[model samples]
Target: MNPLVITVNVKSTVYCDFQLRWYPWDDPHCFLNLKVTNVPSFGLLVDGTSTVTMRPELLEEYEVVECRLQETPHPTNNLTLLVHLTRRYQYHLWTTFLPTSLLAAIGYGTLLLPLEAFAERGSMSLTTLLMFIALYTETNSSLPSTAYLKHIDVWFVFSLIFLTLVINVHLMTFLADSESAGQSVRPTPSRHLTHVSAPPFAKRVRDRMAVPKRILRMSTVLFALVFIIFTLVYFLAIV
Candidate 1:
C-alpha cells in the first residue's frame, strides 16, 4: 500500500476596507471589501487571493472574525477614527441616541399638561430644558470644544428652547386673557343707594348696559400688544 498524501489549507487571512455611511438621523451602516488569501502547508496548485465585498445586507452570513478601528498615528495631526465596531456600537446607541430620544419625549410631555396647571407647566418646562442642557454638556465634554455647532447638539438646544418659550408664552397668555375676561365681566357699584339696595330689574339692566364697550376693545388691544412685545423680546435673545 502507498502512503496517502493529505493536503490542507493551514491559514486564512482577510484584509478588508470598511466604509461607514449613514444619514444624520439614522444609525450608520458599514460596507466591507475583503481580500481573502488562502495559505497551504504544502505547495498546491489552487493558491490565490479572492476579493469579496460584504455589505450590510450580507453581514448576517459571516461571523466577524476581528473588527477594530485602525488608527494611523501622526506627530503633527492626530486623526481620530470614528469607526464603529459591531460590538462597541451599542455604547453610542445607548448613550447618545437613546438619551436624545428620551429628552425629546420629555419635551413633548409638556404639551400634554393641562393649561390650568400653570405651576406644573412652568416647573416641567424649565426642568426639562435644564436637563437637556446638562445632558448636551455632558455629551460634549468627551469631544473638543469648537466654534461650529454639532448637529445633535443643535437639534437638542433648538427643541429645548422652543419648548421653554412655548410654555412661557402659554402661561403669559392664560394670565393675560384671564385678567382681561375678569375686567370685562366686572360689576360696577351704583352711585346712589349707598347702603346697597338691589335696584329695580330695569335699573340694573340699564347700568349693566351702560358699561363702556371701549374698555373691552382697549383690553383686546393691550393684550395683543403685550403678547407681541413679549414674543419679540424673547426671540431676539434666542436668535
Candidate 2:
C-alpha cells in the first residue's frame, strides 16, 4: 500500500484580548491558532512545517516585532503562532503629546512674566487652560472610554491640575496686592506717633508685596521640578 500525503491551507479571523493600561504606549500580543476539526483526534496531526505569512498591508497601525510558531502542547491539539505587536506611536505623539507639552510650556511661561504683569500672566494662563481643555477633549473623543486611567490620561490630569493651580496662585496674589495697596493708602491714625509711623507702614507694605512675589517664584521652580520628574519616571520606568 502507498502512503497518502496532502497539504492544506487555512485562514480565518480570531479574537484578541488587549491590555490598555498603558495605551498609546502599549504593546499588545496575540496568537493565531490553526486547528484540525471534523475528524477523530487520532486522525489529525500538526507539525513545525506550518508557516505564517502576513501581507504587507495587513497591519497599518502596528508593527510586528516578533513572530514565532509553537507546536501545540499535549493538552491543546492545535498549532499556535505568536505575534507581538508594537503600537506605532508617531500619530499619537504628534496629536496629543506634543500639543499638551506645548500648552504646559506656555502655561508655565506665564510664571516667567514680570511679577508686576499680573493681568498679562492671568490672561495667558486662562488662554492656555482653554487650549488644553480643547485638546484633551479632542484626544479623549478619539479613544473609547475605559474603567482605569491610561498613561496619557495621567499626563492630562497633571497638566490640568498645574494650570488650575497657576490660575489660583495668580488670583491669590492679585487679592493680596489689592488689599496691601488699599491699606498702604489708608493708614490708622495715631496722634503721638503720626510722623514716626510712615516708615513702619512703608515697611509693612513691602513685606506684603514680597509675599506674593515669593509665592510666584516658589511655584515656578516647584512645578518645573515636578514636571521633570514625571517625564523621567514615565519614560524611563513606567513606559
Give the candidate number with the greatest lDDT: 2
| TM-score for all models, in order of appearance | 0.41, 0.83
Query: In candidate 1, which residue ranges exceed 4 Å CA deviation?
Result: 1-90, 185-239
Error of 1 at 96 (Å): 2.6
Q: Compared with the true structure, what per-residue lDDT tens digits does model 1 show for residues 95-199?
A: 876776566556556555554565775677677778877887887787434455544455555556655665555556466556655654577777775665556
Clashing pairs in 1: none
Per-residue C-alpha lDDT of model 2 across residues 103-182, encoded as one tens digit per residue: 99899889888778998999999999999999899889988578999887888898899888889988888887887777
